[model samples]
Target: MLTLLLLIPIAAEHKPLLLERFRVIDAPDPATRAAAIATRADEIDLVLTNGTVGFKADEIAALPRLRLLAALGVGHENLDLAAARARGVAVCNGAGTNDDCVADHALALLLASVRALPQQGAALRAGIWRDALPLFPHFNRRRLGIIGLGAIGQKIARRAAAFGMVIGYHNRQPRADAGEAVYFDSVARLAAWADDLVVATPGGAATRHIVNAEVLTALGSGGHVVNVARGSCVDTAALAAALRDGRIAGAALDVYESEPRPPAELVGLDNVILTPHVAGWSPQSIEASVMNFVANVEALARGEPLPTPL
Candidate 1:
């Protein structure tokens, strides 16, 4: 039986399914995980990790028998792809498994931020009425700008379209199948044109802080920003400043530079809404991701191409 070391936390309900197939080693804490890897290096043939808790080159080298490295979700930003390539280890991820869940959350954040739903709800619960509270704008018939035009971004665009939102996007290059969504070459231009900007791009060096001060400035005083992608994609300090100064109306985020901990910069701002990095997490999505991982492992065992190789 192949030994699989899990560096990310897995739900207890899902452990049985993995245990039935592989000798699973569960170590989610960084210190515990490192010790476990060191002690059982020789036994580990497959390693499961996520973008945030990435597997390093030295860790890859420590396991001579490591044949496969799998990311639970679409992101493999922290995974050392070069090391895996050099070592001839198969790399795969659950790419399309949680697209719908993430997109749904993105739209939820967009609507909530635009309509100031959370703020209104809080005021009502505190014994305030609509007459005393500030009125927020409608979410429909506004321009929605997406930073990434990938699968999740496309899904968000589709959902936004239903509400009469005019879609626009920025990418390295315009996609051939973009259809009616207008394309912008630069992020600032996209923000300038959009009433609300949504970030759904991948996390990495190339895309780090893609939404910075300049882009936020272009978004104007009435604009709202939503990020369902990596936290590193948006500069937290910049976002906090913009929100505090009323440079931008409001912001919502599911991910931030600070993981497992709240972003200190934006947590105190009433204009911003925050959720732990769980935009892609749901019962349905988790089950699909786990099954996708199983399928990839089976494909490797059969010497067939992986369904979603990175």
Candidate 2:
């Protein structure tokens, strides 16, 4: 028998069968998370955490029997990889499990921001016709630039093409499948060329603050921006300042630097839309992610390499 602490609640509806083999810990707070680990240190053979709230090196050292660290999603940005590697503990993530859900949310945010749907809805609820208020813009034939041509970005591009938007992207190396879309060598150049910019990059020190004040300013006053990736990919302070001074026309975000809590600077901005970091969440995706974790765990127990080791 093994003891495992789940950092966040998984989909209860899926009825994970591994429950009988492990003890589940629901730790939503720092104190509670640490407390659970401390109390069950010796018995915890596995630790379950989302990509964002990863297990620390010291935390790993505390648990003598920790054999695996299973991340709930593709991102393991906050994970202590070097420490885990040094300890010889296997690290696995739910790769490709939630990409579709996140891509769907990204497109939804992009459409809403560009069409000014929220503002339009609010005006209608206040008994003012759209004609009386400022008209919301259309997205037809607009140039949509995507940053980072990864799996999620590719999915977004496919969906955007259906809406009649011209697609372009910036990446480290040009993807052969990206033949349908134009490729830009630099992010700043891509922003200048696009009427709207979508960010789908990974997070970490390498990509931190890639989208700064200069990039936002280059997007210009009539340009829209959508971020469905990591919050650190774009500087929040720069984004908030851009919205304030009309450096960019509008912005939509589903992830932030400080999650579960919305940014204080963006709270009152009508031109910006904010959501809790739930871009990768959906009924189907949640179920698949849990199943993926279970499969990885089973593989680890059998001394086989994980199907999707991160």
Candidate 3:
């Protein structure tokens, strides 16, 4: 039986299925995780981690019997892919498992920000009416720009299109399958052309601060920005400045630089909406993500190609 070390938390309901398949070692707490790896380094064969709580090079080096590393979600940003390659440890992730959930949340944020739903609702609670509150932009007939044209971005585009919004996107390269959507080579150009911007790009050093002050400025004062991607993709300080200075109309974020803690910079601002990094989290998505991990592990055991290798 393969020994599986879990570095990320799994829901209580999902734990039983994993326990039935492998000799599971649950150590989500950082200190306990370190102790587990040190004590059972030789026994561990497969390791399950998320994109944020990645398995580093040092940890990979310590595990002599490790053969496979799997991320519960699409992100593998913090995963030390180089070390995994050197050690011949196959890496896989649950790419499409949560695409629908994430895309749904992205659209929800976009609609809320563009229409100032939260602010309006708050006003009503404070004994204010629509006449006292500032009028917000309509969601329909606006230009929507997406930073990434990946699986999730494409889904967001389709949803936006249903609302009568014109779609545009920026990617490292134009995708042939993008369908009717206009493509911009640079992020700045995309922002300039768009009335609203949605960021769905991957996170890492390369993409860190891809959406900065300049991009925010290009988005213009009438525009709103929504981020369902990694927080590192947008500069938090810059976003706060933009919202404060009216560089952009408003903003909404599902992910921010501060993971567990709230983003201190934008929390005071009323124009911006924030949700803890839960855009991709839902019962359906969680189940699919766990099942995807199980499939990858089973494929690894049978020497079959992984469904979603990173």
Candidate 4:
């Protein structure tokens, strides 16, 4: 039987299913975890982890029997892809498993930021009858620009369409199904053209800091930005500076450059909306992600290619 190291804790509903076929082990300490992995190198054939909890290259080299490395979530930004490819190890991710949930959360951030919902809610709690007060900024007929036109971007595009927003996008290659939206060959050009920007590209070196000061400035004043993609895709320091200096109108983000803990600069910003890095997490999305991983594992065991191979 193949030994699988279940890096993250599995839900109770899925625990029985995992333990039935493979020898599963959980580690309470990081050193103990590394030790367990190293000690069982010869017997372990698969490693299950998320992008944030990827196995290092040295760890991979130690595991002679390791054949497959699976990312439980869509973002594999931290995974060492070059090493995995060099070792002939198959890497797979649960792409599209949580796209709907992420898109929904992106919209939540967009609406909240655009309409200043948080500030409005705060005013209401203080018994301020602000109906006659000036309403917060809105997107209205503004153009929404998306950086990536993949599955997640497509979902965001569909939602944007429902809001009567014009859409534009920039990608490595032009997509034939982008509908009525125009496509830009460069990110800067796209930002220059869009009134609001939502980044939905994959996370990796290729996409790191795609939204920098130049892009932010190009987005121009009275523009809003939303990010449901990897945090590395945006320059947080630049974004914070822009927000402080009014270089841009406002921003909303579900992911930060330094996640789990946001930058100190953003903590006091009234124009920015922040949430923990959980845009892709929902009850339904969790189930779909787990099932996708299980399907990949089962396919691998049967000597078949993964449905969403990285």
The candidate scoring highest on TM-score is 1
Return the candidate ranking by lDDT, descending: 1, 3, 2, 4
Candidate 1 per-residue lDDT over residues 1-310, each given as its tens digit: 9999998878878777789999999888888888988899989999999999989999999998999999999999999999999999999999999999999999999899999999999999999999998778886779999999999999999999998899999999999998899999999999999999999999999999999999999999999999999999999999999999999999999999997799999988998999998999998898899889999999999999999999
- Per residue, candidate 2 scores C-alpha lDDT tens digits across 7-47 of 87766676465576667666767999889877878878888
Instruction: Output the TM-score of candidate 3.
Output: 0.98
Candidate 1 contains a number of clashing pairs equal to 0
Regions more than 4 Å wrong, model 2 = 15-18
lDDT of 3 by residue, 34-142 (tens): 9998899999999999888889999999999999999999999989999999999999999999999999999999999999999888989999988887777776789
Model 1 regions lying over 4 Å from their true place:
none
The C-alpha lDDT values of all candidates are: 0.94, 0.86, 0.93, 0.85
The TM-score that candidate 2 achieves is 0.95
Query: Best-fitting candidate, measured by lDDT?
Result: 1
The residue-by-residue lDDT of candidate 4 on 185-294, one tens digit each, is: 99999999998899999887898899999999999977789999988899999999999999887899988878768867788998899988789887788778878877
